[model samples]
Target: MKIVKAEDFDLRREVEYGSPEQNEAVREIVAQVKQQGDAALLKYTEQFDRVHLTAGQLRVTEEELAAAYQQVEPSFVEAIAAAAANIRAFHSRQKRNSWMDLQPDGSLLGQIIRPLKRVGVYVPGGKAAYPSSVLMNVIPAQVAGVPEIVMVTPPSTGGTEGIDPYILVAAAEAGVSEIYRVGGAQAIAALAYGTESMAPVDKICGPGNIYVALAKREVYGVVDIDSIAGPSEIAVLADDSADPAYVAADLLSQAEHDEMASAILVTPSPAFAEACRAEVQRQLGELPRRGIAEASVRDYGAIILVDSVVEGIDVINRLAPEHFELIVEEPMAYLGLIENAGAIFLGPYSSEPVGDYFAGPNHIIPTNGTARFSSPVDVDDFIKKSSLIYYSKESLLSNGATIMELARREGLEGHARAIEIRLRKEGKAGEAE
Candidate 1:
């Protein structure tokens, strides 16, 4: 990994995530799916995922779902069930009830919270299997009372046999039945624009490769998306008191994700930076995904030297990483100083993987500098809100002329007339200026 001063570090490296050709490819996929429906979906699935399927074979069947349980071990099943329980318990706290408020003007004003009727969750299945993503994406929708949650994952090989057993088992545990064996930008297109075999969903959520990310970006306005997720990133802000081995291990965890993934360390102590960098090089030799991790760390990863812990916090906020680990002497004392991390790990014990798997928080976090504006996937992602306004005759009569005046100020005669007609009927056209 490269070691540099804070002034030499570039924030722009993480900001620009993908290429234009990737965006254009996603656009073509979305356009074709919208035009040809199942035909285009199946064709692209074959081209991208190497899986060819008929209309009937596009969707996973009940028999396949049942066989998934038999293929997976009992212990694995129990573990997912437990994880689901924790995920459910945490998201249940975010549940919102439709509420009403009675105003002094005798008007009923409130907000109605309603879950999307159906949602689609994309779980990456080609190079890796993230069953944890299934639990993260579907559980919140279930908590929000989403009636139907459909899941899509690319088939493992060119053959259209079935999905990864662990993924199926996780989907089953999370109460997602409508699953399709498709992936890449094609699967995203299929979800955003319904094919003959599938129905269009209200919202789509999950993470994927660059193709998947670009597809979500293309189809954003047509259907709601959680966020334009980027490559996985982690930043560790540590001091001399922190563990070099632990910090190295944590940094390598994200580094192994992909070549584009970023793993950075910021510290004031020069000795600690050298120790951690050496530890990372040593550990990288032992990892199975060493080549990927090595490339990520060598390319995007860095160890930045700051003047102090306060200066480290300034750099963290400037970069706004998706995951942050604070390994200073008093992690909590500097908690208020951090302003831009998607998820913060306060102490040495709180590793990033803990939140990725067993912890209650959703692991589908905003990436890149997006943490400055966006948030992690939660119950709010699966539900929609409607502002409720029941203006009584008295309230309207008293405020109608004021509204008309404002509308007229904007030169919107139609809007002013709409309010004027009701005020005149109520015999209060001249009321409230």
Candidate 2:
């Protein structure tokens, strides 16, 4: 990994999200899915994933779901269940209900919080299958009280009959039954615009490759989507008191995710920075995904040296990494200083994977410096709010002239007229006009 001073670090690499060709391809795929429906879905599935299936076969059958249990170890089942419980517990705390505020004027003002009717969750089946993601995506929607959650994944090659059994088992454990064997931009398009077999949903969530991210960007208005996540990234802010081995291991965890995945370390101690640099090299040699991690660390990873831990925090906020590990001596002392970060792991024991796998926080986070304004997947993603107003006759009569004056000042006669007509009916015509 490259070592750089905080003053001279170049961040241009983090800003460029995807290529134009990839964006254009996603646009074409989304258009085809919208225009041709299942016909388009079938063609793209065959072309991209090397699997051919009819419209009837797109939806996974109950028999397929039942058999998935036999393929995995008993322990896998137990682990997913425990993780689901933790996730449910954490997100349930975030669940909200409709609320109303009564006024002295006998008018009612409130907001109605209702779950979305349906949502489509995209699970990437490339490089590796993420069963944990099924739990992360589905549980929040369930907690938000969404009735229907549809999952989509790419079918693998080598005559694989259906979606990965691990994903199936995770979905089942999370209480989701509707899943489709399709993925990429085509799947996102199918979810946005209903086909003959699959109904369109109100929102789409989950993380995917550049194609999937670009597809979500295109379909924002057609269907609400979770934030456009870029590559996976983790930033570690540590000091001399932190362990070098722990820092290196945690950095490599994110590096192995993808070639574009960034793993960075920011520290105030120059001696500790060198120690971590050496440890990362030693650890990188033993990783199974060495090539990918090496490339990621070599290309995107960095060890930034700052004059003080306070300055390091400044650098961290500017990056706004998806996963931030604070391995300093007093983690909580600097807690509120961290204004940006999707999820923060405090101390060496609270590693990045702790949050990713089992700690109850949603693992799907905003990447590519989007944490400055975006957030991780949560119950809010699967719900919508409607403002409620009940204006009584007396309230309108009391405020009609003020409303008309405000509307007239804005040069909106039609708006004033609506209030004028109502005020006249309420015997306040003199005050309305």
Candidate 3:
């Protein structure tokens, strides 16, 4: 880890937009899926995943879902069930109902909140195959009352029954059964444009590789997407009272995600900063993903020495990290000072993984300083809001002239006429009464 002054360190990381070859390849793949449908999906599955499959084999069978249970342990099932419950409970609070407000003029105005007709969730396979992510993506859509939640993963994740059984088990526990045995940009196009095997979805959510991210960006307007997620990030603001070992372990948890992941520490105490730097190096050697974590720490990780905790908070706000931990002596007192963070974990025990796995908050958060404006995956991602307006004749007569004036000011003659004709028909042509 590198040590630098707060003023000297730059936290802005360049966003990965994929290489030109990768982008062109994704465009070609998306075009093929749009034109060929299921045939393109199967072809890409064989090309990318090296797994040959017929159109009939593209969808996972009930037997596969049932068999997935046998491969996973009883303990895993129990734990997933418990985690699902917490996720449901947390997201259920976020569920909203359609509302209409009645006015004195007999007009009705409000929003009609409705769940999407269908949704597609892409789960990564192989090394990135996290069962917790299955819960994170699927459960919220379910809570939002989305009628159809479809999942897609590669056919084989170097596992004997094709897809990872643990992922299948997680999907089953999350109450999702419409899973397809396809992956990559082709699957994204299939979800967006519809195929013989799968219908088009209203929205797509989940995390994937560079190709997947590019595909999501390609199909964004056709079907709403959660976000163009970037590398994982974590920042810790601690003091001398905080445990250096605990802070180091928390930082590594995110750094181990990949070589692009970032982990940083901001503290006013020079002694605490040195101790954490040493502790991170010590703990990095013990991680199973040491090669990846070591690279992340060496390239993106840093410790900034601030003049005071207030200055540290200012730096954190500017960074707007994906995950933030406050480990000062009085964590609660400083909570109000945090302006930007995807997820804030205060005190020592509220580790980042707690929110990632079991603490009920969605781990799919904004990254690359996007927390300044965006938010994590939630029920709102699975639902759409339509504005409801029911104007009474009296209300229209009262406001039609103002509406026409604004429309004409914008030089939209048709819009003004649309309101003027209505007013004229009602015998108030000159001006709204």
Candidate 4:
């Protein structure tokens, strides 16, 4: 990894960045799905997923799920259960309750929270089967009280199967209703604009390939999306006290995710920078995905030696990494300074994997540079809030004129008349004036 002084690092170049071809490809897939619907879905599935799924066999049955349990080891099943429980427990805290406040004049204002009637979660089964993603996406929706949760994954080929048994186990633990043998952009399209076998979802959540990202972008207006996620990333703002080994390992955790992923180390120590660089080389050899990790670190990774802790923090806030690790003497001291970041990991022991699996925080986070304003997937992603208001005659008359004036100022006569008509019907017309 190349080490540079913090002043030389360019964040604007990172922000104004995206390939035109990617945008064009995504737009085309989205249009094709919107027009052809199920036909388009099946065609893409056969082409990309290597599965010739008939419309009738899209949904995974109980027998298929049972067979999955037989295929996977008991230990893996137990782990999924454990992770599911942790994810469920943590997200339960995010559950929102409806509340209405009534004043003396009988005016009520509050929010009514309700889960989406049905939701679709896309789990990637191409490069790898992510059972943890199953837990993160489903548990939050379940906690939010979504009635029907549909999961979609590519069917396996070469004597392989659909979603991994561990993924099925996690889904069972999370109370997901249906699983579909579908994948890629086509699956996203099916979820967005219901196919013959699939019901359209109010919202779609989870992670997938570049094609999936493009599909989500295409169907965003038709269905709500959590985010248009990018590649994984991590930024560690450390001091001299931070351990080089831990820093290198955590960086590699996100780096191995893809060649596009970025891992950055910001510290005030030259010695620490040198040590981390050496540690990364040592650890990269041991990782199963070393080639991917190496390519990612080589292309996107950086080790910045800042002049001061404040400068280090400025770099962090500017880049807005998805995973922010505070490997400093006083991690909390800089906590408030960190205004951006999908998830914050404090202290040396708080590794990135902790949040990825057991930490109870959602692993599906805003990636690339989106953490500057975006957030991680949460229970709120599955729920919609409606503003509820009730106004008595007295309350309406008192507030009506002010509302009318504001509406009329904006040239919205209809809005003003709507309130005026209500007052006129109550036999209290022009009372406010």
Q: In terms of TM-score, which candidate is strongest?
A: 2
Q: How well does each candidate superpose onto the true structure, as a TM-score?
A: 0.96, 0.98, 0.97, 0.93
lDDT of 2 by residue, 1-433 (tens): 8889998997545455579899889999998899999999999888888888899999998888999999999999999999999999999999998999989999999999999999999999998899999999999999999999999988876556478899999999998889899999999999999898899999999888889988989999989988888779999999999999999999999999999899999999889999999999999989999999999999899999999888999999999999999999989999989998999999889999889999899999988888999999999998999999998888899999999899999999999999999988878778976
Q: Candidate order by TM-score, highest to lowest?
A: 2, 3, 1, 4
lDDT of 3 by residue, 311-334 (tens): 999999999999999999889998
- The residue ranges of model 4 lying beyond 4 angstroms of the native Cα positions read 13-37, 157-161, 421-433
lDDT tens digits by residue: candidate 1, 1-433: 8899999988765355468887787788889998998899778877876777888888898899999999999999999999999999999999999999998989999999999998999999755799999999999999999998999998877665578999999999888888998888888888888988889998989988888888888888989988877789999999999999999999999999988899999999999999999999999999999999999999999999999999999999999999999998989999988899999998999999999988889999988788898888899888889999999988888778788889999999999889887877777756633
| Candidate 2 wrong stretches, greater than 4 Å | none
Comparing 1 and 3 on lDDT, the stronger one: 3
Assess candidate 1 and give its lDDT.
Answer: 0.90
In candidate 4, how many Å is residue 154 off?
1.0
Answer with 3 or 4, whichever has the higher TM-score.
Answer: 3
Q: Best candidate, lDDT-wise? A: 3
Model 3 alpha-carbon drift over 4 Å, by segment: 157-161, 429-433
RMSD of 2: 1.2
Rate residue 186 of model 4 by lDDT: 78
Please give the lDDT score at residue 349 for candidate 3: 98
Lowest-lDDT window of 10 residues in candidate 2?
Answer: 10-19
TM accuracy, model 4: 0.93
